[model samples]
Target: MHYCPYCGSLVIEEEKYCMKCGKELPSDFDERVTSSKSKWKWWKYPIIISLVIALFITVLFVRTQQQENDAQELYQQAEEMALIGDYQTSKEYIEQALDHKNNFPTAKAVLDFLKIAIESKNTINDIDALAKNQNYEEALDKLTAIENNISGFKGDLINKLNTTVSDYRNNILYQQAEHKLTNDLSKDELKELLWEVEEITDEKAEVIKEAIQEKIVAHTSNHATELLKENQFNQAMLVVEDGLIYAEESEQLQSLKTTVEKEKIAFETAQEERIEQALTIYEQEDEINRNQAVEVLNVNASVSTNEITVTGEIKSVATVPINSILVSYQLKNNDTQILENDVYVFPETLYPDEKGKFEFTHFNKEIKNNDLTAEVTKITWFID
Candidate 1:
C-alpha cells in the first residue's frame, strides 16, 4: 500500500495517481518502473515481436504519466474551490479525479467533510418544513437523521431537539385520552384507560388523569339529575353515595350531596305504601339406606385371672369385611348388673382389616375374689 502524499490516506500501488488528492506523478519515477519489470527481461524473443512489445509498453507508460498529470491539475483546482467555500464545485472536481484512480486516499478525506456539510444543510431544511406543517412526528425523524449523519453539531441543538420530540409524544397521548374520556363509555372501560394513562409520564399523564377524574364526576352527576327529575329521594341518595365513591374529594361530589339533603325534608312525607304477609308450608320426604357397623362382644364371666383377653368376630348385617375393631371393656364386679352404657368412643378415621385383639386388665386392687366380667360398649375399625 502507498499513502496519498497530500492527505495521508492509504492507496493501492496499481493506481497511476492519487485517487483522492489528484496529485501528480513523482519526478524520479524511472527507477520505480524499471525495478518492477527487471525480473522477466532475461527471456529472449524474435526482434519484430520485441519491437512491437516495446512500442506497446511505451504507449502504456505515456498514458499512465499523462493521467497522473491530469489528476494533479484537478487537485489544485478542487483545493482552490474549497478554500473559497465553493464546496459544490470542489465536490464535482474531486469526483472526476477519483474516476482516474479509485484508490486515492486524499480525495476520500475531503469527500467525507463535504458530505457531512451537505447532510447538515439538508436536515435543517427538512426540520423547518416539518415544523411549518405541524408534523411533529416527521420533524423528530428529520432531527434523528441529522444526529446520525453528522458528528460535530453543537450539544445544545441535540438536547433541544430531544426535548421537542418528548413533548410532542406526550401531548399526543394526552389529547387521545381526553377525547376518549369525553365520550359516553362505560365506567369500567374509562377506569381501564385511566390506568394506562397513568403509565405515561410527564405532562401527558397528568393531563389525562385530570380529564378522567372530571368525566367520572360528570357521569355520576347525571345520576343526581335523574333522581331529582323522578323525585325518588332514597334512590337519589344511593346515587350520590356512588358518586362520592367515584369522585372522592371532588367539588362535584360535595355539591351533589348538599343538593340531595336539601330536598330530603319534603321528600320524606311521600313514602307510605306497604304490603306485608307471612306463609309457611311443611313437607316431608322419607329415604332408607342399608346401615352396617361392627359389634364386638365379650362372652366369659368370672375369668380366673385379673388379666383377661377378649377375642371375637364382628357381626355385620351385610357381608361384613372384618377389620381391626377397637374393643373397649371396663372390668366390673360380677355382682354389678350390666345395664345399657353410653360410652363415647373415638373411632378411627380409616377402616383396617385384621385379627382384632384387645386385653382388659382389672386395675382395682381391693377386689379379693378373681370374679370378673367384660362388656363391649363400642366397636371401631382401623386400617394399617
Candidate 2:
C-alpha cells in the first residue's frame, strides 16, 4: 500500500495528489507503480495470440506466486506499524494485504485488532480526561464498555491490548478510591467506592478497602449516635445498618448495633410507661369532666385546601345555669394525638337545657390533616 509523502496517510498509486495533505505526488511515484504492474510490452503483444495462449498457464502460475509474496510483505508492514502504535496506518496496511489476498486469516485478524485497538486508545484518552476531572464513575463505565467491545477476537495484539486496558482500569480505580477514602465522604459515597473496588484483589486496593471500612464504622457510628440522641430510633437503626454493610465484623459497628438495639428497647419501654401514665390521667380527668354535668355535642369538622374547621355545641346537663366556661381539648389526626389547647365556647354561658356553640379553625400549608378530631378533655365553669 502507498502512503502520502507529506502526511504519511494512506494514498492510492493512481492519485496525483495526496488526499489528506492535498500536495502533488511525485510523478516518478506513478511511474514506479505503472512499471511494476505492466510487465507485458505492447510490441511483444503483437507477436502472436497463439504464443500468448501457450504462455498463459506458466505466466498465471508466476503471477500468483508474486501476489502471494506481495500479500506477505504487506502483512509484515502492518505488523510493524502496529508495533510502533501507529494503529491507523497499521489498519490500512493490513486491509490492503487482505485486498491482495482476501482470504488471509492472519491479515484479517490483524485488521480487526487494529480497529479495536485504535478505538480503545481513543477511549482510554477520554477516560484520562475524565479521571483528571474526578469523574470516576463515568471513567469506570467507559472501561467496562471497552472491555465488552473487545468481544474475544483472536489476534497477536489481543493479549497486549487486554493487559494495557486492564492496567489502566485498575490504576484509575485505585487512585480515585484512595483519594476519596482518604477524604471525608458520606456513608453512601464510601460504600459506592467500596463496591467499585471489590473486584480488585491487589494489595493497594486492599488498603483502600480498609480505609473505607474504618470510615464507615466511624462516620456511621457518629451519625447514628446523633440520630439516637434526637430520639429518631428508626433512622439511627438505618444508619447502623449502613455501617454494618461495609464492616460486618467490625467490633465498633457490632457494638454500636447492640447499643442501638438495647437503647431502642429501653426507649420504647419508657415511652410505653409514659403513654400509660398519660392515659390514666386522661381517663380520670375525663370521668371528672363527665360528672361535672357539661358535655360536648353535635361536633362537626371540615377541611379545605388551606384550613381545618371544627365547630361543636356544648350543653349544660346540670340543674343550674353555668357561665365563664373554658374547655381543654385534644386535637387528633388519623387517630394519633397532635396537639392540645383550651377554648371558651361562645356566649360563655349555658342555662339548664340550653347550649353554646364553639368553633376552631387552623390554616397552614404544611398540615395535611384529612382526618382530624377535636375531643374535650377538661371543662371549667362557674355556676350562676
Candidate 3:
C-alpha cells in the first residue's frame, strides 16, 4: 500500500499516483501514510466539524454586519438631509432604513424626530408661500399656530421667518397706501389713509408716508392754482385753508396762499379804480351841454321804510325842441363816498322851454349807506 503525499489518500504499491486524490506517491509513502493517519485519526472528524461550524458563523456575522452597515448608511443619509432642512426627503430615507433593519434603534428614533421636523418644516413653508402671495393675515395666523405648537424650534430659522412675514405685511400696506395717494382723493380720505400709513412700524413706512404727503401737498396746490387762474380767489383760499389742515408745513400750499392773497388784492384794487373812473367821467362838465340842453333843478331826496325817492325837474334852457333827454345822477353817503350811481333817460320830445319832472326811486334795503345825495351828473339834448 501507498499513499499520495499531497492528500494522504491510500493507493496500491504498484500505482504511481493515488486514484482518489490524483497525486503521485513517494517511495516509502505507505510508511509515512501509516504514521500520519495514526497521528490525525483521533482529532480529524471533530476538527472538521468545528471548522464548518466556524465558517457558517463567520458568514452569518458578515451578513448581519453588512445589514447593520447598510442601515447605518441610510440613517447617515437621512441625518445629512435633515441638517439642511430637507426633512421630507430625510423622512423617506429614515423609513427605508427601518425597513432594512427592523430592530434598528437609531433609525427608529430618527424617524420619530423626522416626523415632527417634517410637520414643522411644512408649516413654515406654507407660511412663506402665503406671505409671498401677499396674504399677510392668513400667513400671520399660520405663523402664530406654528409658534404655539412647536416649542424649542430653531431660533435662526424662526427669526428669518418673522422678518419675512413682517416685510410682507409692510409691503402690502405700503402698496395700498401708495395706490390711494396716487388717485384723486379728497383731503379727508387721503388723510385717513395717511394715518394708516403713519401707524406702521416698518423702516420704509416713514419714507412712504412722506411721499404720500408730498402728493397731497402737490394736489392741493395744483387745485388751488386752477381756481386762482379762473379768478375764484375766495374758493382758492378755502382750498388752501383745507390743505393746511392736512399739511401744515407744506411750503407749496403756503406759497400758493400768498399768491392767491396778492391776486385778491390786485383784483379789488382794479374794481375800485373802475368805480372811480365811472364816477369821475360823470363829474366832468365837458360831456354835458349846460346851455342848449335841459337843466336839472330842485333836486330833493326822501327816505321811507322800504324805499328812497329822488325827485327833480328839468327845463329846456334853449329855444329848440329836444328829441331825447338823459340825466346822470350819483347818490353819496355822508362821507361823500358814492354809494349808488346811475343814468336815467326820458324817451319823449320836449318842446322849446318845456319843463319835465323826473323821479328816481330805489329800494332802501338795497342801499347800504347812512345818508344819500342826489345830483345831476350829466344831461343830453337833441339839437334841431
Residue 118 of model 2: what lDDT? 97
Per-prediction TM-score to the true structure, in the order listed: 0.26, 0.46, 0.37
Q: List lDDT for all candidates, in order.
A: 0.57, 0.79, 0.71
What lDDT tens digits, residue by residue, belong to model 2 across residues 1-384? 665555555668788898788988777764334331233443356676768876997799888878889999998998888877788998988888888888798888777778888998999999999989989889989988888888677555666677777887888888888777667788788888889888775668878888889887889989999998998888988888878878988998888888889999999999999999999977775554446668778766677887767777888877666787887777788888777777788787777778888777767724564777778878788764
Residue 36 lDDT, candidate 3, scale 0-100 = 56
Could you give the candidate ranking by lDDT, starting with the highest?
Answer: 2, 3, 1
lDDT of 1 by residue, 1-384 (tens): 345444544556666676777775354444224321232332334665889999999999998777777776776787777655566787788788787657778777766765764565566667666665566556656656656664453333334444544454455445556656667877667767777677457864876687777777777778778988888777888877875665578887788778888777655543321111111111110010023344443334344443333333434322334334455445466657333222322322223222233433333235556565556655544322
Positional deviation of 142 in candidate 2, in angstroms?
Answer: 5.5
lDDT of each residue in 1-384, candidate 3, tens digit only:
445566666667788777887765676744535545654765498998999999999999998888888888998888778767677888899888887789987677667666766676677677667756767567667656655544444444345444644565566667667666667777677778888787567888978777777777877888898998899999999999888887788888888899999999999899899889977864443234345467666777777776778787877655556666767676666747454555454546776567787677777445555477777777765655
List of clashing residue pairs for candidate 2: none
Regions more than 4 Å wrong, model 2: 1-106, 133-156, 199-203, 230-235, 264-384
Query: Which portions of model 3 miss their true places by more than 4 Å?
Result: 1-171, 179-189, 282-384
| Deviation from truth (RMSD, Å), model 1 | 28.4
